[model samples]
Target: MLNIPLMSNNISEEDKEVLADFIRTSDRFTNGPKVREFEEAWSQWLGVKHSLFVNSGASANYMTMAVLRELYGPGEVIVPPIAWSSDISSVFAAGFTPVFVDVDMSTLAMNEDEILSHITDRTRAVLLTHVLGLNGLSQRLLDELDRRGIPLIEDVCESHGTTMNGKKCGTFGLASNFSFYYAHHMSTIEGGVICTNNDRVYQMCRMFRSHGMVRELTDEDMKREYAEKYPDLRPEFLFAVPGYNMRGTELNAVLGLNQLKRLDGNNARRVENFKLYVKNLDPEKYFTDFRMDGQVNYAFIVLLRQASREKFERLTELLRSENVEFRRGTAGGGNLARQPFVRKRLPDFDPSTLKNTDFIHFYGLYTGNYPSLEKEKILELCKLLNRV
Candidate 1:
């Protein structure tokens, strides 16, 4: 562990071999066997009925929304402001309007109470995120949603190996999403998977993942004149709804499966590092661990007691000089929303829409955590941060 940087480079020889093996075989990029293998592994691991692979976490988000629009169109969905930029846009892309809500300060997840206040006759679902693996809000929010009979789609992208009260994190909601991004707990190089217990969602999502094509045709359609002419066509791949070309490649899935096999062990190591940070660092006056339920610690973070731009930059510079790399913990409204394109598209959008997210935008700072981070590196990070 050289002075801990944002994240250690994490592709191993084994992962490389897996990727190479997959590509050397099918290499067709689309409808490849490795994608199914990866999706199936995720489906079994998450205890969900179905899973679909996509190019990226953002692609998964947009696909989820696109599918949702087909079933439940033009409805209001509740989302926390403290989320990835793409998470917010998927709402608009799917023809639904996002009703941003404040988040609980501790969990940084959707504030159920605030959600209740925002819900109207138009409310259809809650796109909930288990922010930074803090899951205390999940059960309460789920209970509220149930009481109101509203549906929920979980964003478990940040909390893949996390759990609450012995139950897995992604299993609580109807449809849950996970990402195997380069910087995430697992590395697929670049890929995402959506999980669901519902048959309808599973059915719809398959078409959504593949450019809205009807992929699995029924016997009636296959027997018709269309079936005899096109042997290469799949009935299921047909477009049922307006969807994106969000299919995953075999290479990515092969890499992901290999990485997925080690997900638990990696999470455990990060937790060990998390405890080291807690035991060695002063918690009462400096930073708090956010008291998470089962954090994977993808990005070990803390909220500072004070917020000063100058101090923030100074600390960043100090860490940089020490050869430590870090990043401001992502706030809900990503740089995407603040970008010129989003601003113009949402010109009349109300500034009052996102409030709880503003706090995290400035106060949160995260040290990188990846499978490559060694014990020595974490210790070095602790020593450097404490020196300040």
Candidate 2:
């Protein structure tokens, strides 16, 4: 039913050949040398000291939060209303209360003032997501968090090449998460990574990625200390933390390594695609003044400027007739507070408080934007929407 789907496979035939060759030659297939190589490459690319490869971005989220909880103890975490479920789920799982903050309409990130205002003595970290490849970070926000001594954990699952102040979004945070799902900037079939500069956090994450074994720690001295501390248990079998088997395989790493080479080039194309998209869309009828600097948009966000049930319905009808696939309530299904998961936990939660988030929930939708997308098609889609 869809002529223009939400996502097209970015994985190339060359990537497959590399994987095939690896499979034919390598004896190891599980979490081994290739995975470590990919992790190192990703760390270098992201400008972080260490990276831990995991099964999914959701696992990266959970592991980062788990490590944070182990190191910082239980506390509240400031979160954005328009974020992936894993960002909040990781917080809840880490035994931290999620304090919601409304988003800035322009950037689609948590308002800097709102996030700062919600900070309390109990607040442990601010888990911010660069929604749909938009850089959801600012200099003032970083400075304020640093001044308050609160860690800033970034959920960069959707934003791979997005930057702020000439540095990648993930590099600025205490720890950041990335996804390599098929639809993302890159693909490993299914994989994710956690990047950090903190040595202790890096070591802990390495252990957590496997079965929390001392053997997983890269530092020899730390492994020795753990071994000395626990004599009864075997050094290799000693579990420092109750960690899950969230390890990624060598095959995924192989795909990732191949994809990594083309990431920058592909991202450049996406940036251009988004620019062309906003250039033609009718600004009066739709909102197009998004913060575009340092952005590599994942999709073309079509948000109505004013609330009109007639316009919304007509827009959907036109898209359907044209067979252009899209997702409404773009980015984290709009306001997360309105979701049953949040409401069931906090019965008093109100969605109206997050005005910008709620507006997007009702009126916004995102269509696919990938590297190979045709320019003429983009113009045609904009023209169709402008008519609506």
The candidate that wins on lDDT is 2
| TM-score, one value per model | 0.87, 0.98
Model 2: per-residue lDDT, tens digit, 101-145? 999878889999999999999999999999898899999999999
- Report the Cα RMSD per candidate: 3.8, 1.3
> What C-alpha lDDT does candidate 1 achieve relative to the native structure?
0.71
Q: Tens digits of per-residue lDDT for model 1 on 319-378?
A: 778766666755443323454545666687654455545555665666676666777766
In angstroms, the error of model 1 at 238 is 5.0
Q: Which ten residues in a row have the lowest lDDT in candidate 1?
A: 216-225
Q: Give lDDT: candidate 1, residue 317.
A: 78
Among residues 3 or more apart in sequence or in different chains, the pairs in candidate 2 whose N, CA or C atoms overlap within 3 Å are none
